[model samples]
Target: MANQTPESNQPSNTQTYGFPIYAADWIPEETVRSKIDKDQDNSEDVGGESSSSTSRSCIVLAGGGGEGRSGIKNVIVICRVDLDTKSLAEQPLGRIVLGTDLPYRMAVHPRGGGLVCALPNSCKRFDWESIISPREGDQGGEEGEEVINELKDVGQQLALAFNQEGSVLAAGGEDGTLRIFEWPCMKTLLDESKAHASVKNLTFSESGKFLVSLGGPLCRVWDVNASAAIASLSKEKDEMFAYCRFSVDNAGNEVLYIAANTERGGSIITWDTTTWKRRRSKLMKNYSISAFNVSADGKLLALGNMEGDVLIIDSTKMKTHQLVKKAHLGLVTALTFSPDSRCLVSVSFDSRAKLTVIEKTPEKRKGSKLAGDVVVVRVAIRGFLLFLDGKGDHRQRK
Candidate 1:
């Protein structure tokens, strides 16, 4: 794709001048009918299996390009391969067309039924309609119920994060409160004290006993069963402007990690959940920290910055391990580790993502830089690497 340099003063352009624009081209209408007919015939001949299925796995993405900027423009199913692959072997799923009034956020529910989407306005309740439905005598895999109607009063985006295990869902909103919902029945089990600001992120501990909320400068840890704030961590004498993100260890120990940047600059703070003890503080330089991730095993911590540097730290020793400077060309928006902790992945605003396998190295490479560190050693069953990127594309790292 050719990079375009727009005039600095282009009135309607939201991007900066000299920035590379990234958008899928609208298919030409003149060729639509013939392509549809050919695709239909191909599907019928193949017993409903898509041709791309002969090659790679596919995932659908939720984003813009629908009608009026709010309508259901189109759903894109990418036949994605690992970035290193020369070609992908995935198939495309059929697109469900809708008017320009579709929700801003759509989530695939844990129950494997219909999804819950957050629509415009303060509307709550999931507008659920069937999107994919399993057939008789069929085992549920890709086939599942689809969503059609809007469930009113479902709450806003950024306030909720599902556990993806089909058991628990946590939501917080502008009302400065957090609510935990149990699956299948979808009832509000617990509602905690009001937060300091609109809750931006709600995360559950690995064991699902605790919920970490990122809102104001102070990050609050809530007990899931008791439905109360167990601990709140903050910087001394600072206004609550939290860019906080958290993760838990395999033992379900809560670790609240916060990053804030202003005229006074930023620091990455790590707190122990059980005692609410401030374990360690790292002073940052040159760039502001953007996002962070803690490994499932709780040994490694990855903090990404705006300057594209990803500082991999040793959780036990509280020191830096490996530093991938300019890990991504653009702003790093997301970071995630595999279930087994053998690899890591990151997504960026630069319109590209990276999957880096945690190479097993000598013990010298492991502990020499960061004390008592253990590098990822082996692959999981099925030879699949556990790294995951949050950019709508979830693929097994080979």
Candidate 2:
């Protein structure tokens, strides 16, 4: 793919965090609120109405240059996104520098359990309290804090995720081992040594009844209750599976989506959760998808490609609602949607993080509350610019 530059005059709320960001996710709103409440209780000035009612969302980012003596420090940092000001914090609220151990992938618990990061040889869990409330003698008041006692020595996991309810935790190992454990307790639910050639991605269904694992050429769906494989989906032709996610349609029916790339282009293949059969495949032009995520409400699907372009598709129509050309200068490493589904956060190897605000223009016709096909995406980065779609003109958002 050819390198493309965004409009120079367009404003962006982006930040260069020194180190490249490989994994990023929004801290749950409830979690943030809890932290705020805790701080208020400890402070002499007890809040009456709460000063940070409108504070912007916060996200955790983890990545580094590895153990190559590259000077860049391996670290995990929390940053605040100020929507009111349309800017990212110049500095992180908290940071932890790991000398040599690099965090490859991370999953933040949905219900404020904590954060689980994929390290070189094992997956370690970090508590939310420890990260937000730094202690003395700790590096940046965030380092040297021991990982959650239960998650020690879990083995080298390539993917880590917690179900939406935060009751179940799943880990996919580099050696094709898949382990599903009951959260907090760490009781084993399912342990498959040969779940795949190498477990690349793992996602749980909305109901937490099924788990989808993708690696190599196959994607398998496991029955969570039975702790056994229920269905296996294989790639067709030259298609290569990249990411998998579970979402529900407008009618509240469960659907599975798999991001796949082929010689032709990147496409999203939807599957029927009931029969585990292919439902539909939507191609995304010539872009090879590198990162994929669905909004919390299951209304929008976000995709970041190798060319640094970000596309938002309406879940119901599966049509491209908005597209940002050259959203980053390097491969887009990760994409995540805010808990409210109002904003999307994307990070790239360029050491830049951007937040795109979703603005829906709903059309009311004869008592219908359906949103219009057109979605004006206000991308808040270096400068704010509104994009309609691929062919639409870009204009400054007032």
Candidate 3:
């Protein structure tokens, strides 16, 4: 993909840029979706399909924000590209040249007004409005400009999240601590160390009533206001959990889903928020889950794997699971869906981000069921393999 110029109203194709700046080998562990909305000019594709304002999702990338790079350093960039939008997708709307190193972690503010990034021993905030502007501005001088704020120190910060009301910010790091703060102000409210052995993922519930933290072999739930561990979902002293998130439903109840690796393969577990207990744990696939994201509407889930495939799973109906093989040429770093659920944005260690149109899955008539014999056979094979391997979530069948 060719580089895009600094024009927002031009054709969407004319605004996409490829990210070859400060390329690195290891993939970042986080990817976040942006909800900011706007209207833009139209540009018809060669095939006559308009690639204009219908973009529900945009792909953004962060590199060493500035150009010249000595080896690889931690550089944060704010970029947005709509569905069918080009790559590199022009320059990022915002950038931060922090001296932190790789394995970048960032979160888009729930209100879509700001962004927070986490690095080793530090965390910082950036204004989203100015980052997206076509014009560049100085730091802390004007509204929507590059208003960079260094949050209070967070030791070895590994993950960051904003509450649903956008009032609270959470940062989790290597010291097994979870830091909750008032947004913008960055005032520390609760410092809960010993949250885990090492906090790999931290997320707030849709209602901001609960927070979920995932560390290797441990999953703990906490009450937001009380700051106490309310539940522990599932843990294996021998296994490790790589990713976890809250799946919100229409009824406003939230379900906790986590990805873990086993001797058999990679599997997902969903815990009931009401009882703070796991309701289901099932094998999602054989591929190691590297990244996953849920659509805001609570209907869809996207999973990226080590094999570079993105698995689209239906939250309500399990049969709608579809696979996009080799969605990335290398290890996929992050994958996210647009607020409207019509587009998907993915980035990889290949130093590139892509905006892909969502394809409609062919419909299947309701009440259809898998063949009983086929199901039995498949389960028999899997059980035999698990038996040979000596251990698994034995309660599960297929």
Candidate 4:
């Protein structure tokens, strides 16, 4: 669990819960990095870059081709920010071009050792240093013909995830199989076909003791070492569970959350890990859930709906704490909290990702909604050009 900081700077959030319930006016952060736009091979286009900077976190965004883009393939964008100024670096860290197929899941190593992503053909790992600062004539690990000769015969790429320690990576695909490899080494460990008809998502328990896979007909929890199923769930109502995760309790117990889109909309189901039995089942929304993620500390869960709305749920109570409707022009594709729990980042199919700060507030429990006051604030991306404009000539586009 993450340590909670003092909330003395803002008023007590006893009225609206701790959620940044309101979207304040947007303000852009000042940056010292330059931006770049380039065309390559008359086949694909690449965008977004940073000049240089010292920053604590970088966001990796995956998007398919868009306007003024020639290729149908997915493009990778890396954005680095000062984190202190709550602003972007003058430029981006870098970008990776994966041809023809749409890119999906991405996993960055905790120690910055490497990055693993689902390519159009295969899931590949790359050294971070190589990606950020490539040598002349080098395209990193997942670029060009280098990746073509590796990670073959796996069928279509589907899901990707790394364990807490980043020592192991798991990937699922169209072949109803699951593959686990040892870190940057990419050594084959367990290759189990029949993990399901096809896995919609892949995840590891908090302790990395169990691997969970969700499918249309069944969900299985596997013992990582033995590579065997410890528990299996088949719910008729939930034809599929596209999203699931393992969160920790105060006593350090792992709690499992599973959700799916039903006929009416979506259903959220949770299980007690110790008992491996269903704990709660509830209809969360009238629209299908597109993407959702739990905070690293397991305190908050942010869910996006097909209608482009985002709802913040209290992890403990499994109830809505705040609602931000119409969050995106199109459906949300991904949303998760920064490692420090200070920022919530969300990306959409519309080819955009936005970052919002999480302010300090009181902890609210289940039952009747608590009346609390929350301080709402909104900050724009792209160097936050609005707020710090004309302050200094430190900002420019490359």
The number of the candidate with the highest TM-score is 2
Ranking 2 against 3 by TM-score, winner:
2
How many clashes would you count in candidate 3? Answer: 9
Give each model a TM-score. 0.60, 0.82, 0.71, 0.71
Candidate 4, residues 1-398: lDDT per residue as tens digits? 01123663222111111111111111111111222112111112243323223334565555555321553435555555345556533333555555454455666565554555666567656544344443344233443323423356566657777788788878888778888877767777778888878877877998888888887577888888887788997776544577888888666778888877787877778889988898887677576888878888888888887677877777777777777777666677778777766677666665445565665556465222332212112233434665567444556641
The whole-model C-alpha lDDT of candidate 3 against the native structure comes to 0.61
Quote model 4's TM-score.
0.71
How big is the positional error of residue 88 in model 4, measured in Å on the Cα after superposition? 4.9
When summed lDDT is taken over every stretch of 10 residues in candidate 4, the lowest stretch is: 18-27
List per-candidate RMSD values in Å: 16.7, 12.8, 14.3, 17.6
lDDT of 2 by residue, 1-398 (tens): 01113563222477778888899999886767767455544442542322354755788999988985887778888877766656565556567766677899988888887788887766667776666665465354434344644445756678888998999999898889898999878888998989998999999998899999999899999999999998899889999999999988888999999999989889999999999899999887788999999998889999998889999999889887888888889799999988888888899988888888887745567234222222222223213422334224433332
lDDT winner among the candidates?
2
Task: Please provide, for model 3 over 32-124, each residue's C-alpha lDDT reduced to its tens digit, 9 standing for 90 to 100.
Answer: 223233322221223233444444334334544232354444444555454454432454444534443442677766565555556445655
User: What overall lDDT goes with each candidate model?
Assistant: 0.50, 0.80, 0.61, 0.61
**Predicted candidate 1 versus true structure: per-residue lDDT over 1-398, tens digit per residue:** 11224552221101111111111111112223244345545655886533332222222233334345433243322213222332222233233323343334444443443344444433233212112221233222222333322223535545555564658777666556677777657676776546756676666765677787877666777887787887876656543334554566456666766665554545667777678778776655554666666776777877777776677777666667677877768666656665556556554555343445565536775466564232223334223433334322544333
Question: Model 4 misses residue 269 by how many Å?
Answer: 1.4
TM-score between model 2 and native: 0.82
For TM-score, candidate 2 versus 4, the one ahead is 2
Off by over 4 Å in 2: 1-12, 34-52, 134-155, 362-398
